[model samples]
Target: MGFGFVATQILAVSLPILLGWALNKLGIIGGDLDNRLSTLVLNVALPCSILASIDGAEALPDAGTLVLLMLATGVTYVIAIAVALVMAFLLRDTEDARVSYRFAIAFGNCGFIGLPVVGAILGAEAVLYAAIALIPANVILFAVGPLFFIDATADAGRPADRLRGVLASLKTPTLAASVAVLVLALAGVNRLGVAGQALGIVGQMATPLALLITGSSMAHYRPLEMLGNPRAYVAAAGRLLIVPLASLIAVNLFPLSPFLRAVIVLDGAMPVATLGALYCLKSGRDTKPMMQVTFLSVVFSVVTIPLVSLVL
Candidate 1:
């Protein structure tokens, strides 16, 4: 059953990529569709799925295991980032490569990839736990992830200007929406039936749209350059395999609930967030490598995610 669930998510994620590629190849979808799909994903689908899965979830798991799992994740991410640093330095990679590698390890595709994978592996309730995990993940992304990229390039403006950029990043609509959904779920209000139903419909769209957008973005890549980048492969391996394997070992020994354990294990197994490309763009780094990392990470997760799921 668990393996089947993992397969469900793997298919859900992969279908859009394959479909988008096909549609583009057939001239049925254009570049503009990618932008629209991205907006639908971030603005509507993601929040709805979260709300639908978590709303009225009164049987929240014991904090002991969840807390331990969260801590384990944080520790694993820190370790992965350290490994990425060593890899970047050993290869004599550029500042952008270092930043991209670190960011890839630091940020996992929690919502875009994590929610559906958790849902399939452990049912909707696991996704509820995934929502809980997202709080800390957001903290790391909006606060810590930015710091790594910020220093990669020089600041041309005053200190105040730099501070403002950090502040602006904090106000991201996606983060704000995730927070809103979490707060409402905790309150147990459900926001009435129509609102919840509407949210669910939107949530269902997120995975497909995200896959499509990622696929479209991937259409811009150079295959030889992508294949030649060793950092991208290592980064994918660290994010999809090493971190999750370490988490699975810790989780098995930690006295955690099965559900929390599942969430933690899946969270660690997530692919690299495609948004890393945007971060690299903002930080004045070359985006081609980051895109390569994202594309490859998603591809490998087809095998890695199911392996992680079966272990959980």
Candidate 2:
């Protein structure tokens, strides 16, 4: 069953690459399709997806699930940070490389890849649990993640700047959607109603659009280059293997629901976040190692994710 689930996800992720390659070959790659698709996913589809998952629920998850989720999320981050520190210590040659390695290991592609895969395997309710898990992860990613890039020699900015960054990060559409859906669920909204049905119809597009964008972007890179980087290989091992194993242990200790446990483990097992390399680029840092790690981790997840599913 695990292998079957992994196979389905791999096929979903790969078909778009072929489509992207065909688009490139036919000179149809010059349009703003990437941006358009991205906007649709982030703004329209993802929010609807979240809402559709929760809008019909009689109530939010029990307090126990919420508490366990918070604890498990914290443990996941701690494990990620610990693994990253170990990697940095072992591979310490340059500050930039250290930062990139740590960042890549600490953040996985939970939103783009994890959501669809978990939704397919564990069902839509599992996806909702994953979204709840994402709140803290995103907070750490956008808030504390930038601090990793700041050099000790650089002047730390004012408190206002840090507060602003944190606030800005929390303003993401998906997060807003999560909050809204939870609110509606608590308020007992009927998801089978006209509004709910409309959202569900639009929400169905999120998974495909996300996978297609990932596949299309991947087509432009050379697999050989990604595979050859030693640092990237190290990061990939940590991201795909060590972190997931640790997350599995941590989640198991908490007595979460079976679906929640599966969601946490699978999300933890995912490849490097697609945006990690982009963040590196925007920060004027060396993006090669980050890109290599991202590509290699993703390439290898087809195997690792399935293995993780078996454990769950």
Candidate 3:
């Protein structure tokens, strides 16, 4: 995409985020509505968006290319986890601090920020690649995600629980939708006719809805407090800067198309997943560390994501 196209796409995506923040601040939408809308976007709009992208695509990658994309994505995550482990040692103040660093750096806001931004800036075709990338990310997140925030020694975390999480991760709505769409596309079912039209209409909602939820979620966190954490700044640097740079080097080893290459770079460039904060809250862990990184990485990303686009 041209710089002009990227700029237009960023502005279009950024507007909903601003509006969502304003709406939450004014109490027009928050609490239950925000939660429900998040569910709607993740389960409905985002999946439909994935399907519609493939349905409308003029071309489809062969099964081998898709497998290669999955492996490339898996390698990216492995590199990220290794980076997180190394950084955790450098930041070893407390176990909690190490946990925060590892979690924040290793995973990204791929679904909420990466998906929409890629779709908007790179077109729907890129979103298909983004969807493919999500498979390995989610699998790793499930298999070992909680260990980042949950102490291995904690009594509350059982082996069975971890195994269940891994199994359940296999069934996430987004993953399910993505796999289903890929099968259909492979079977020459690209055009769903009227169903395709309906899906496209619903799919259009994913970007705006995901960003709105992101903005509204940000409203609940204290920006000044989030900004003041120097430790969080360290984590943000690893996430927003270090990880993307490392991902670029790692992805280059593969013979990927420029489109797949851009997807990996943009994926690495995204901010912390807002889901991480929610996970901390539900687990009764201190959410402050990740919330800070999430807030700062997000506020900084409007600039950084565009910068990463230049590399594409």
Instruction: State each model's C-alpha RMSD to the native.
Output: 3.0, 2.2, 1.6
Candidate 1 per-residue C-alpha lDDT over 1-312 given as tens digits, one digit per residue, 9 for 90 to 100: 456666876777677877877777677765777777777776667767776775556564454645665676666566656666666566567777777887786678887667766776577777666766776676667667767777634654686876677677666455666566556554554544777777777677776677666666666666677778887898788778877777666667666677677777787688887668877887777877677777788778888888877776
Q: 1 or 2, which is superior by TM-score?
A: 2
Best by TM-score: 3
**TM-score of each prediction:** 0.85, 0.91, 0.95
Ranking by lDDT: 3, 2, 1
lDDT of 3 by residue, 1-312 (tens): 667777777788788888899999999988999989988988999888887777767887888878888898888888888988998788765676677778888888888678989877887788877887787777887776776776566675567887877697678688887787768756766677888888889989888888888888889887788888787888888888888888888888898898888898897789987767767876777777878888888888887787788777
What is the C-alpha local distance difference test score of each model?
A: 0.70, 0.77, 0.81
Model 3 pairs whose backbones collide: none
Model 2 per-residue lDDT tens digits across residues 119-154: 876777777778777777777777777777776786
- Model 2 lDDT-worst window of ten: 181-190
Error of 1 at 271 (Å): 2.0
Q: In model 2, how large is the Cα lDDT of residue 283?
A: 69
